[model samples]
Target chain A: MALVELVPNFSEGRRQDVIDKILAAMKEASTAKIIDSRADPDHNRLVVTIVGEPEETFKAGFAGIKTAAELIDMDEHQGEHPRVGATDVVPFVPVTGITIEECTELAKRLAKKVSDELGIPTYLYEAAATRPDRENLANIRKGQYEGLKEAIKTDPDRKPDFGPSELPKAGATVIGAREFLIAYNIYLNTDDVEIAKTIGRNIRHKNGGFAYCKSMGFATKPYVQVSMNLTNYKETPMAMVVETVRNEARRYGVAITETEVYGMIPVDALLDAAEYYLQLNGKWNRSQIIEKKLTEME
Target chain B: MALVELVPNFSEGRRQDVIDKILAAMKEASTAKIIDSRADPDHNRLVVTIVGEPEETFKAGFAGIKTAAELIDMDEHQGEHPRVGATDVVPFVPVTGITIEECTELAKRLAKKVSDELGIPTYLYEAAATRPDRENLANIRKGQYEGLKEAIKTDPDRKPDFGPSELPKAGATVIGAREFLIAYNIYLNTDDVEIAKTIGRNIRHKNGGFAYCKSMGFATKPYVQVSMNLTNYKETPMAMVVETVRNEARRYGVAITETEVYGMIPVDALLDAAEYYLQLNGKWNRSQIIEKKLTEME
Candidate 1:
């Protein structure tokens, strides 16, 4: 058994009935554990998080897309967040006993299912992209719901990897596979936001920092914060990023006030932190964790 | 569905057939997980580790004891470790949703069962002790098997808590409840044994240090280590212990090399370290961990 995480973003956040119906449909269709469902009215999007076997997650994700298509009209949808479909984007992340390539296969199966059954064109992005042009989600969603509505029928470049090259009432969906993203924030003692910004800039990928990190600085009320989205915890670990932030803060005569993990995070992240901070010399296996051995793979 | 860990020590480690029979009986009798079983020939003892619901664990541990009694004759048993019975001692430790008091009750039930049914005398120690004199395990086994045989029939001070005054072929069994013992060792960068010994002394309870810590210094092949048995992790956490060692090592101008956790450890121990070292300001609950939420109470 494998544990794969699926985070599906739907374009109907303000309407509780629509989200509930979609959630109920997902719960009915799949055996996956629906861990969380968050709706932001400002973004007008509902994001659901689940952990289960790859096939079970696909069944749940497909149900969500089908239900969203039936209830949400893309033309009527308006929000601060960008969208190209009622079910905007769905990503399959490998949790345990599964590889990224395997998740890509699961993503492909989900895209084909939504496109064929719902009569809505679907584009594969990220690891599951059919072409180099469709690799980035920003590329697939370059044209919003209204723009893509016209482009899909005409432009060969705008054509989806599945279904007819025509957009329906639900519009086009972008589905793919990606690593788990950790929403981590580090708070600084100083009131100065400049120091936070500098550390953020030096530690984010675009500025020749850690490869899989995207960070920003903010002056949030009581303390300055260096907020980050760690894209690949295995490649660029949490401990290294934190230690770097600590060392950088010391140069400015400041210390870390506290830290925050914004949402649900895998146990491995904390276990990794334990190994590094405690200076465990790779003398133990993760199986030695009694709870882990007892837990069956999702 | 409370999780309780039971570690049972039997007096025959040199005989593989006897150990196998005991393990098989426990596995067949109880719907509980037998996570580990270690045999130390020098001590001539077998220690089996189990984690399950209180009743299920008690059934499994009882099965092991019954099997050990039938196979091992204590009069012929000789070992480096102190023992008064074929199934020397069994200790129950609380894992999750289970209290020490509940475990003590389970211990008492096991003690009474072995004594009444098996016709072997039983003594309670630690949290399950009937009297102040029986609180220490060493006090209960003051006269090993050979000496305890005559003492049990003659001396009032050496009387057992349960069963007849006459000794059986299997001898006496000791049962009780105690906190989980983590065999943790911290290695220093230097070869100096004195620094390790001093740090060990300052951190152990017997010398007026951390309440539940028991430590000793050892000069292993590569490093001088402060070997420890942390009796209660909730009160004296792993992060606090390691940090204290780091702080103490600084006084001797030595740095820590690495640390080791000898065997099975509860996931909470590592999570405690992560929360402290990462400086999470009570902003996150352990329930927020995806794995923790997915796992049943056990």
Candidate 2:
């Protein structure tokens, strides 16, 4: 089956009633399954994860965006995380039997629909970005809600690819397609947050480290963490990252406490590491998995 | 979905027409997918693998057995491999969301139906065996067709589990349930068969080795092979076996040339090894897989 994963972030998280209404509308409007939903009071935002065929996923995404636009007013929103709209960011990821190009097209279609129908401006980022300047989401969401509200009226570069030039009460949503991202974090034995911050800066892509990694360091009580997003596991696998971090940690006289996978990951990402460590000879395909064959039959 | 895998060995493999007929009948019978089929001319047997929901899988397995019994006659059968019937052995395996006990129940239902409707005596072996001696398939298939033909009528212990004690024209079928078995083989750098034999003896369960392994040694061409059947992967995983064999081979001044997995394997088997090698902290699950979540949603 052609499967796509949709992960969208909303501005409201402190209120359960609004979150429930948006979730209810998403579940009712499309056949896609909402696998995971997290509401963080600190971030004051909600992150919802869903997966299904492209057509159904698009409809579900649109439904959630519509509900978020109706229920949340960005003027009243406050969060620890960056945001530009009530429904902040919607990213389409290729799961199985799907291509990045196909996901890009799906993102564009959803962006246009949400913009035209909901009167919410939308910017395409990542693989579906129309302009080089808007390729990265952080770049498009540079000013946040307040700054973007003024910039949209004065700057031509700030004008969205779709919807009216003026920002609506719901603000603007950033929609795009990208490869599966693995949110991995490794904790250090010592409670030195500075050590973690130094390692994170040295290993992240933006700081000239692994090509697809974005990392930061955080102090969470007992231990310090080198938190990261592996944007493309195929490019820089889990083992390589873990080992590099381990070697880097040794310099600070600290050991790795443990590593964690934050969310759902594609099977191939782990299988690739398995094959490498096991030294499996020759070629092995996913068809060799009984469940994979069963899924294909379905 | 409740998934069950059926691997049936048919007595007639030399004749293409008969094998094709049985294969076609199996495909037409139910929605179960035929994953693989291999006809061994020397053994004069056909091993067909199929997997689906329990009900449909049972129907397809029955259809294949009925077709094999119709096209094959025990009186004229001759082969290198030992067999007691036209449809020699049918093993039901639990693939996903199903237990060995559930598969044992499925095997018994298939056995009773085949015995009563087709007038073919059936013996339940392995997990579904009524007698301790019948638990091992090699023991149940002892004496072959010619020897069992006379013994079933005389020996009380030889009486079939279902149908009449006397053998039919198609002979008797052996049906049962068992855990997924992994057939793995390792080739040694040296051509010394005795080294391979000694290692096999040391690693097999019967010789006080790993509890779930059954191994043998064979000299094929330039290398000697240590062939094994891992009956229960959860008990004795692939990494443990490979490491054991590697340690044993070092004693003989021999290195492992390569290792191979024979057929389809459960994803958990490899994932288990991945976790051990990677040292993933805390509890990790198949739910972390995007495809697994998709399957669950279905």
Candidate 1 per-residue C-alpha lDDT over A1-298 given as tens digits, one digit per residue, 9 for 90 to 100? 5788999999988999998999999999988889889999999999999888789999899899999999999989999999999999999998877888999999998888887788889999888998988888888898699889889889999988998898888989999999888999999999999999999999999999999999999988688999999998888889899989999999999999899998878888888999999998767777777777766421
Estimate the Cα RMSD of every predicted model relative to the unseen true structure.
2.9, 3.7
TM agreement with the true structure for every prediction: 0.91, 0.86
lDDT of 2 by residue, B177-258 (tens): 9999988888889888999999999999999999999999899658898999999887899888888998999998898877
lDDT, candidate 2, at B228:
94
Top candidate when judged by TM-score against the true structure: 1
Candidate 1 chain A, run of 10 with poorest lDDT = A289-298
lDDT (tens digit, per residue) of candidate 1 on B1-298: 4788999999989999998999999989887788888999999999998888789999998999999989999978989999999999999999876889999999999999998899989999999999999999999898799989999999998898898887898999999999888999999988889999999999999998899899988888678999999999989998999999999999999998889999878888898898888887767777777766766422
Predicted complex 2: DockQ: 0.54
What pairs collide in candidate 2? none
Where in model 2 is the C-alpha error above 4 Å? Answer: A14-21, A40-44, A70-81, A116-119, A186-209, A214-227, A245-258, B14-21, B40-43, B186-202, B206-208, B214-227, B246-259
